[model samples]
Target: MTFLETLLDPFQYQFFIKGLVAALLAGGLCGLIGVFITLRGMSYIGHGLSHAIFGGYAAAPLLGIPIVLGAGLWGLASALAINAVTRRHRIGADAAIGVVTTASFALGVALLTKFGNKGPAFDSLLFGSINGVSIGDLLLLGGVFLGTIAIFTVLYRQLLFSTFDPEVAKVSGVNVGLMDTILMVVLSMSILATLSIIGVTLVAATLVIPPVVARMLTDSFGRMLWIATALGTAAGAVGMYLSYQLEIPSGTTIVLVNAAVFLVVLLLKGAKGLGRTAGLDDHTDASATGLVTASAPTRA
Candidate 1:
């Protein structure tokens, strides 16, 4: 087969096409939210919340409820609980996260062991089954993507201010507490949307790795968001294609691809730093003069 034929092979099947769309949407949305997650150093929240929501998954089938609905509610409640506990009790954020999330996960495991029967397999829930995405899932993802864009568009300034400088934002009447709540809610929604695509085990990586990679590539937040989204989409698409070709698990392949990209960027950054050091060594006198000039003060 030719290159184009090989590339287009997966598109011939409806499930593959759906998986492609689902992967891209999941990756892009996670990447978008990941910027804030990274900036606020709340990456653990993603992991914690993902695990916490597993309780809903464990209980849903036994209760004759939709798994996504149950999981989403649990995830949202977890986010709110974390926020409330850390704010009200003066607990460390990490400690709050660890306590609540682990408890939720433990509850889930217990519930599943006791009540789960011939429902969705734990493997699919934990590891993901992107190729199993349905049309309804696609619609849900689309709604989430649009909702995310709308929220960010409407609250960009407040969100940015709160994220980088909460004290200043609060002094400026930005409602830092409300902003935090909003961010947490949005994060919960993002996590819910990503659960099926990447599954609970690996969804947090999707929410983190892309932004970290983008941070390595740029200093501008705007550029960081765009770069991260693009990198995530690219990783998902490429990973999906690679998984199809190799018959590997899509979620694992996607994460591996993301990690591979991160490693490449790290190497490039290191090389660039080395090159700058070499250039500085070659231009020691010029560098000293420039440094002195840069440090000089001017009188108005």
Candidate 2:
């Protein structure tokens, strides 16, 4: 096949087309929410919620219900429970995440074992295959992508204020508590949105690595959002293509691509820093800003 034919070959198939759309939507949405996730230091929350959703997935089949709905509810409940536990008690957020997530995951594993072959295959749920995406899945992913954009657009200022400066935002009447809840809700839904495309095991990486890489490249939040989204979208498309050609797992390929990108950016950033240290790049600007620091007040 010619180079152009090789590139266009995947697009000739309906399943491949649907998979690409799903990947782009899931990746972009994850990238958008990931900015806030990274800034707020809630990476663990993403991982925890993804695992917690497995509980609902394992139970939904037994109840004759849709797995997505069950998993979404479970993910949301986990997010809220973690928020409530950390806020109402003296315990740290990570501790609450550990307690809630592990228990939920264990329940999922036990249920799966008890009802072997009744539910969807454990391998499919844990490590997704993008080629399995259907029209219905594409529609759901589109709805989620649109909804996320609307929410982010309407609440941009409040969300940004609360994320970077919660105390100041509260003083300015931003309703820090409510904003935090909103963030959690969005985070939960984002995890659910990516479940079918990336699965529980690797979804959190999609929600994290892109934003971290974007953060290394830019100081401005707006730029970071754009860069992250672009990076994620590109990674998803490229990874899917590579996976198809290489006959590898889609979720694993996508995550590995994301990680590779992050590593490359990290090395580049380190190199730049070293150049600055050696006074080899006097024209280099100062490090980017807007990332959360240890001194910043964080909401549990």
Candidate 3:
């Protein structure tokens, strides 16, 4: 069917609409938070948090509580825990993430096994099956996305300053520590957004891959957010479709597609950089900018 035909298709259901809304909201939030994650060089931290939350997910089904809520709470706690340990010691953030997430998730598995042997259901949380999403899940996802956006908007200048130049932000009284804590919280929420919807294994990719691809396409952070969001939305939808039509796993297929997109971007960017040195595509990038102009955000 054509684009118009598809829109008019009666096969369109509320579930599909909800899924799309969830994906868009999740994608935008991830793209925004990912800028900080990518900039801070903490992709592994994102991975650790997503995995650590599995313990909560395992407990949720047995307790009959909100799975996302359970996971988000634990994820946030993990984030704060990482921040605390990394701050008071020589252990870098990455090392802290490695230690905490793996241990917590392992403990979660052991505890879950002891509870009622409900391990397979817990596996679904890790693998993700959007086919099972409900209205409640959509609402929860939306709430997290909006709350994160509002918090970031309120601290826009301070966060940006702290991210780019923490010492200067501290000297200028920007509350750098608070911003760091908030950013980590947002990052945890981003993982929660995708944990059950896209599964834990792919959650980090949904946050990192699109942003990494978006980076090569533009230099401006603003533009990068837009491009990454677009890529994320596309990846989610197309990946789901391929999974359905091909009868493959939806979450894994989408993640693989997103990874492929990232590989392509890396190759293109790498070739360009190599060409620049080899004088193949040797030329100045007119797109480079010293600051954000009104037109500068077009790519984002």
Q: What TM-score, over all chains together, does every model reach?
A: 0.87, 0.88, 0.82
Candidate that would win on TM-score: 2
Across 1-300, the per-residue lDDT of candidate 3 in tens digits comes to 798775445237665556556655665666667766765667678778988888777776677777677777888999999999988899998899999999888977877768864533555567666465678767777887788778877876676656655665577666778888999888887787766557777777777778777767776656766787788878887766555556555568778888888777778789653332221122122332233122221211
Q: What ranking emerges by TM-score with the best candidate at the front?
A: 2, 1, 3
Cand. 3 Cα-lDDT: 0.70
What is candidate 3's TM-score against the reference? 0.82
Better of 2 and 3 by lDDT: 2
Tens-digit per-residue lDDT, 1-300, candidate 2: 999999788888888878888888888888888888877777788889989988988888788888778878888899999999988999998999999999999999998888864655677678778666878778777887788889888888778777766777677677878888888988888787777778889988998889878867765677878998998888888878777878777788889999999888778788653343231112122332233232233345
Which stretches of model 1 miss by more than 4 angstroms? Answer: 1-4, 117-119, 271-300
What stretches of model 2 exceed 4 Å from their correct place? Answer: 1-4, 271-300
Estimate every model's Cα lDDT from 0 to 1: 0.79, 0.79, 0.70
- For model 3, the superposed segments whose C-alpha errors exceed 4 Å read 1-17, 61-65, 117-120, 273-300
Measured with C-alpha atoms, the lDDT of residue 234 in candidate 3 is 84
lDDT by residue (tens digit), candidate 1, 1-300:
999998788889988888889889988988999888877778889999988988877877778789778877888899999999988997988899999999999999998777664455677667667566888778888898899889988888777766766665676677879988988988888877777778788888988889888766755667778988998899888877777888876778889999999888878897653343232212232433343334332233
What 10-residue stretch in candidate 2 is worst by lDDT? 279-288
lDDT of 2: 0.79
